[model samples]
Target chain A: MIRKIFVIFAIAGLIMMLLPLVVNFEYKDSLNELSSQYVRGSIDDLKSQNVVTSVIVSYRGLDTLGEVTVLFLATAGVGFLLKHKKNKNSLRKASELLQTSSSFLVALIILFGIYIFVHGHLTPGGGFQGGVIIASAFLLMILSDINLKFNHLILHLVESFSGAFYVVVGLIGLLLGIGFLNINIVPLGNFGQLFSAGAIPIVYSLIGLKVGAELTAILNTMGGEQ
Target chain B: MTLTIIIILGVIMIAAAFGAIYFNKLLAAIVSAGVISLLASVIYLVLGSPDVAMTEATIGSGLTTIIFLFALNKVRKENKK
Candidate 1:
């Protein structure tokens, strides 16, 4: 009797969870007014080929700023919670295969990450994706060499300056242009060119560097073991 | 059909989730959770959200799994002491 009751309750719970998807199962027929406006005006305003990048870095820029702040805070919180407490001698050496191959792979991974963020205006990828990729490369390096150390001072400098420069660019827009993060400071050379999007690439690169440094710092802190 | 494929993916995700909960070894459970996250990202890709799919795949499956493993290692080390 108890087993039957448990099975029935589980079935009922599953049905309840899935009921909303079944009820609201219809294809979207048209784009809403805000999205329609974004799609139509993004290229002209931002000179970015990728609509997603235009939306993220130009149109809804404030939201992206807030998101970057949240990530910074999360990294800081993790660092504080996992303060370096482990003995330095406790970390064992990595395997020979990992130690040898990571040196070759690390450069390629970092380069690929830079490429993804640098071409944010014209490509599918943007700052966050590239930043995480770079952090992953650093993670590989850290895993390979237990004795390796990143210069905390340099990481801090990079993170702070990039974040501050992102805001300074926004302030420049606010002072001399239409509004904050207007992207009209520099010439929008051409629609599809590498340097066409005035401030989009610049902003994304700053974001990428900031995020990469923050995440790498978090990894270093968490894996400190001392 | 797209719907059939989506249904199959959903079933697979559900199975992975259950496996994550029921796995005896903590490492196996963590890996099972990663599998569920990876499959969910695939579903996101199929649904035409490539951006979301990329974030989910890289963060959920890649960095998160590493972080969890590190945390687990720390905990096991503490337990040993």
Candidate 2:
């Protein structure tokens, strides 16, 4: 009874504290100075339609690099913790419906994932989202076939190469006297074009491939595929 | 109209959160958690952030749920052995 009363009081106190903020919240009608600058820079300088993508891939590139490293560490930790032991006896096969649908859907899903990252500067979707979508395709295959064996060599190669290329691209920018990870390493083509975002798409594509390969590796490790 | 939809989604999300806590079955709880994430993605879309919405839907709901299910399956198999 005391515990329940304590919970009630805690809840009430929290609501009392938060309710004033909710009621008094002022909705902003315009972008602040920093946001307006970012918006302008994204369009005028980067020639990128998606302001968010430019900010993530160019302006804050090092932060994103750090984020990718964190994800790699997580994948490494999961792989370390989960021992890859092959199950000798096969479990019951997945439903025919699942097997048929997944096989048909995997290619389409992967294509969509590629399109997302390739057009990251022009669209709302980007590298991380595309990478997760690609990972989902592998996950679907794993769900359909428990005995499936993934080629670790190819997965590792893709993951490592993409990561190395990302850093190399950044280095190229630094060597060119542009700030690190600057998108002006190449010609900023006609605005709103697929190739207009300079190095943003390339960086995003590398991120997508690296993220996809790392996630697939994690899934493969967890799924017990050697 | 948008406000109404947002309100409804918020309610459903809260209900799902409670359902996740209330459910005894681990699978049901996981499903409830996924529901919350899926609805949050929708809310993010309604708020005009499609990038965030896609990330939330894919990573938060899709991959996380599958990972949880895989973990649960592994635990159940070990228990059986």
Candidate 3:
């Protein structure tokens, strides 16, 4: 009836939409000219083993900084909306096994988060991914323990300092005639080494700290702990 | 083989999307949505973007699920009050 007709039409529409993808299956293993140039230049320009990190933290630093600001604004908006008026403890206490295991895992999770961001320039992970991992660890901690409190002061300090320092580094690059947010200000160490990728690692680490703190603060505020 | 895997994952994603929409319980729906996000991460991994896959898995599934649960709890509390 009408339902069957609707389903038929929906399927037809979906098939029509996806027809182009199947018909135009031209997947290229090699980069296009522009991307090939970027790939070749990145080694000499940024000296980062991970071209993705070089693009994200160094080439597109300002854009990433803007994204971070948007996140900061979003977290601030949430805090304003969900700010607790009365400190009424509402969360039920989790079980003993959950509590003990969560506490034990928190440190390990934090360590992993740090590792992901610290090696961002040399690995597939980066600041945003690592920051979310750290925030998830805090989320787990929040779930297991009802009475646990976060040090908001430390979170704020980390957020502000990292953001400011990111800008400061960019400004320094601008002053040094390396263009804004360029990694040329710092010497590109031997490639593939942890110390390589001038300014990329430092920027990503700062970004990781800032993002981790911002997300943790948002979670705390949403959970009515702030 | 890869095409078959992609087709299977796509089916699962569609099924999860339907479950998220049709489930009566809010918690069930949220969990279903998380499953959809996780399946998407797997697809991203298969498509040769491990970094995007990791981000989608961690943020889209992990943190978003918790946030939705918190919001659901708040809504339930307010409804009860």
Backbone clash count, each prediction separately: 0, 0, 0
Per-residue accuracy of model 3 over A1-226 as CA lDDT, tens digit each: 9999999999999999999999999978888987776677778777787777877887677899899999999989988888765657666789999898998999999999999999998888989999998988998888888777888889889999999999998999889896888887788898889888888889999899999999998888776443
Q: DockQ of candidates 1 onward, in order?
A: 0.59, 0.80, 0.75
Q: Report how closely model 2 matches the true complex, as a DockQ value.
A: 0.80
Record all residue pairs in model 3 with backbone atoms less than 3 Å apart, i.e. clashing.
none
The fnat of each candidate, in order, is 0.32, 0.68, 0.72
**Candidate 1 lDDT tens digits, A1-226:** 9999999999999999999999999988999999988988877777788888899998899999999999999998998888858454565689999999999999999999999899988877889989999999999998998878788899999999999999999999999967998888889888999998889999999999999999899888876555
Q: Write model 1 residue lDDT over B18-67, tens digit each, in one string.
A: 98888899999999889888988888888877777877888899889988
* Error at A2, model 2, angstroms: 8.6
Q: Judged by lDDT relative to the true structure, which candidate is superior, 1 or 3?
A: 1
Instruction: Please tell me which model should have the higher DockQ, number 1 or number 3.
Output: 3
Candidate 1, position A97, lDDT: 95
Alpha-carbon deviation at A188 in model 3, angstroms: 0.7
State which docking tier applies to candidate 1.
Answer: medium
For model 1, what is the error of residue B24's alpha carbon versus the real structure, in angstroms, after optimal superposition?
Answer: 2.2
Q: TM-score for every candidate vs. truth? A: 0.91, 0.94, 0.91
lDDT of 3 by residue, B1-81 (tens): 778889999999999999988999988999999999999999999988888998999999988998898888777777876
- The numbered model that scores best in DockQ is 2
**lDDT of model 1 at position B72:** 92
Off by over 4 Å in 1: A1-18
